[model samples]
Target: MRLLTQLVWVFTVLAILLAVVLLFTYDVIKVEWISFMEIQPSHRQMEDPLPVPARSIPIEGPVSIPGMLPPENPVEADEASIARGSELFEIHCRMCHGQTAEGNGPIAPFLANKPANLTSPIVQSKSDGSIFLTITNGVEGKMPPLNENLLVHDRWDLVNFIRTLTIED
Candidate 1:
């Protein structure tokens, strides 16, 4: 009887200890160890970000439809268009393509693949449509696509500006 009583007492203590431990592990007791990561900003997986900026999509139509030939340059390369392209180039392309589009921008050195020489024959030989498509869909890994960053008209304008860049011998 004494042995049985002892065994029962030990078993009851162990069961109570296990239950208490489970309560904390399962968060039943509300005791939690806060982590530093919890305080930092985090985005949930597959969470949609803010809606695309206004005018990002032109009402006219899509700039370049895939599986088809590159679209022709719709925006004329007039002085005004060139001027706007110059300004956009300075703001966006200058960081990578440099002021003269010579692939020697201040940030070019840091990139794994150097920016292409816009004035080179290899670049100039391409059609205006090809250039526009490149800007819309960036050279993978080497450059980021400007589809969302620049309007359709602006891409054409930039392509026009690129045509004017020539190597000064």
Candidate 2:
């Protein structure tokens, strides 16, 4: 009978403890953001407020392209210029246009639009300006812009090089 009373007392204490914990914990409100009493300025904001005066940059040599290179100068159909253009073409363009300008490169088969044949008489008939324009602003869904990669003078050199491919020596 004494043991039974002791068990009842223990159970009663446990129930009271649980009820007190629940009361304190239940429907608890949480605070997230704390409003700062003081504000700190960033490095830029803390620095000098006066604007520095602009100065002119002097040009010493031939100016290069700002972002996209201008076309290369068109040279005569000489062996040396053609050779130089050929080298440039091989490095930059041959991957897409082919080694012989035949519209057949490794990537040619995979391209949705095949590369143009530079040696075609039809291609030769087109004005240099037309070719240069095409090289500068590539055909939509066909070619990418060379202006970003090649200068204006280089494009003209490429054109001269292409002409050499078609014309007899």
Candidate 3:
């Protein structure tokens, strides 16, 4: 009887340990020794973000449908907006578009397709919306789309700054 009782206790302890291990293995329970490194699914920054439903319009405005006319610039070309655009342009565009916005940037000669002179008559003649679209989507095989790098308002501000370039010419 004594041996049998000891065996029963051992089995009970073993069963509890197995259950705990299974629970952790299956993620039924989570234990984090380091709080910053989350072990939960979909929580890490490197992990793919949660998916949005299809056809969901962004809260900011309508999506710029390709082949359709570019959206109007909602951001006003005020001093602050233009100033911000100038700063952003210098950081993101000056290397390729040049200090004068003349497409003779330091790297222009190295590229297979030279950057467009933003202040050229052809570019200056384009509608603000068209210029905005070009900035957002970029010219295929020539320029890269800046949509990912810049926010919508920032792009509009860039448009304003580009307008200033034409004015300077």
Candidate 4:
């Protein structure tokens, strides 16, 4: 009878030790008991976010409607607007477009596709509305969209600043 009890105790102790080893090896075990967060839905880093609900305007207002022609540049290219655009370009574009808007920004060489030269006639000839759309939608696989980064007015300012790149540098 004593041997039977001792055998039972040994098996119970071994089972408990085995569980401890398993807990560490399978780290996710008993996570629900540890914290509710482990079981909740969570986003991973760099995860694509949920798409915006259809027909929803941004809090600032509609930038452009779907299936519409590229919207016109509503913001006039005044001195202040151009100045603001210059600042925005430096902050947002200088890394790739360069100080002279000549596609020689610090990171330009590192990119697989060279950044476009804003001073070039190709870019200069594009309509202000077209430039605005490029800034909004971005070049596929080349530039990332800035629509989320800049407000409508800010983008227009950036377009105006691009126009000024034509002067002799």
Candidate 5:
């Protein structure tokens, strides 16, 4: 009983000494550190008003996306093109878009923004051109620019793959 009492007293004294040291030993104490909530270029600041490089012929010839076709010629979606697009989608898009194109892939939870549910009717309503543009340029918070990672043909293929996600009522 006496030994236990002595041990308790020793611990109490040590804790008190430590608390006093921490209180006085520091030359300066800051309650909070300076921080920045947002530290990136805004959308307006990043926008480019200048004209981009002129277009060249695509490898497979004129392709059509729903909203982006030239007024004179509208190309139809071919089976071969869609098949190619599916291949590219599996290779580059499956990891984030899911193997079924459901937008519930393994990496979805960790992303700063959720991937779009491509199967939605609203997305399906968009023209192929709009889909192609989104694939090429990406949505501000949802997708990333895949142009560098994928060739122009591959991007077209991805557009077709997105088309396949639309369920016909």
Candidate 6:
């Protein structure tokens, strides 16, 4: 009996020590036995981007310089264009601008700055290019820049949709 008790105690101590060593190895030591998933760069890495030559035209065509007369509205406000614009507006703009474009969207109250009323004269009076720029660059502290989320054509479509809002008022 005495020998059995001593064997049991020894085995228990050994098991606990093994467990402690494993925990330390995993949590504190962080031994990387197999580094199959290390943070090395792959072939798709963009470490050094090529610089564009001075006065090079943009690949997407000429971008209007801000403060110049708003670039001409290339996208016509035809029925098809308006329909596409309306769809894009609902997906991106409605969350903040509201269904009626009155700056009363469900999330509008939660925002730090209220969205501008799209149908208001101040907004409607601006040239289409100005509206397009606003959508592209966004108002500081008030709106977010949609240029990343929206394509240039989509922004133009949004401008066309905004025009319909003024017509309705």
Per-candidate Cα lDDT values, in order, are 0.86, 0.71, 0.85, 0.88, 0.70, 0.85
- Candidate 1 per-residue lDDT, tens place, 131-153, comes to 98889879998898887678888
Best by lDDT: 4
lDDT tens readout by residue for model 4, 1-169: 9999999999999999998989977984654456757776666878875677887887867877778877788888899999999999999999999999999999999999999989988889888988998998899999989887899889999999898887443
Model 4: pairs clashing at backbone N, Cα or C within 3 Å: none
**Per-residue lDDT of candidate 5, residues 1-169 (tens digit):** 9999999999999999888777666734434444565454434655654343468545655444446552221334578878888888888777787877777778888887877777877678887767776777788877886765677666766777677776634
Summed backbone clashes in each candidate are 0, 10, 0, 0, 9, 0
Of the two candidates 1 and 5, the one with more favorable lDDT, higher being better, is: 1
Q: For residues 113-167, could you state the per-residue lDDT of candidate 2 as single tens digits?
A: 9998877777788877677778877888899867656776677777778777863
Best-first order by lDDT: 4, 1, 6, 3, 2, 5
lDDT for position 106 in model 6 = 89
lDDT (Cα) of model 6: 0.85
lDDT of 3 by residue, 1-169 (tens): 9999999999999999999999999989986667654655554566655565788765666648767877877888999999999999998899999999989899999999989888888898988889888887788988988876788888899999898875445
Clashes of 2: 10
Which candidate do you rate higher for TM-score, 1 or 5? 1
Per-residue error for 24 in candidate 6, Å, reads: 16
Q: Name the runs in model 6 displaced over 4 angstroms.
A: 1-58, 167-169
**What's the distance in Å from true for residue 29, model 2?**
28
Model 3 steric clash total: 0
The CA lDDT at 125 in model 4 is 82
Give the worst 10-residue stretch by lDDT in candidate 5.
Answer: 68-77
Output the better candidate (4/5) by TM-score: 4
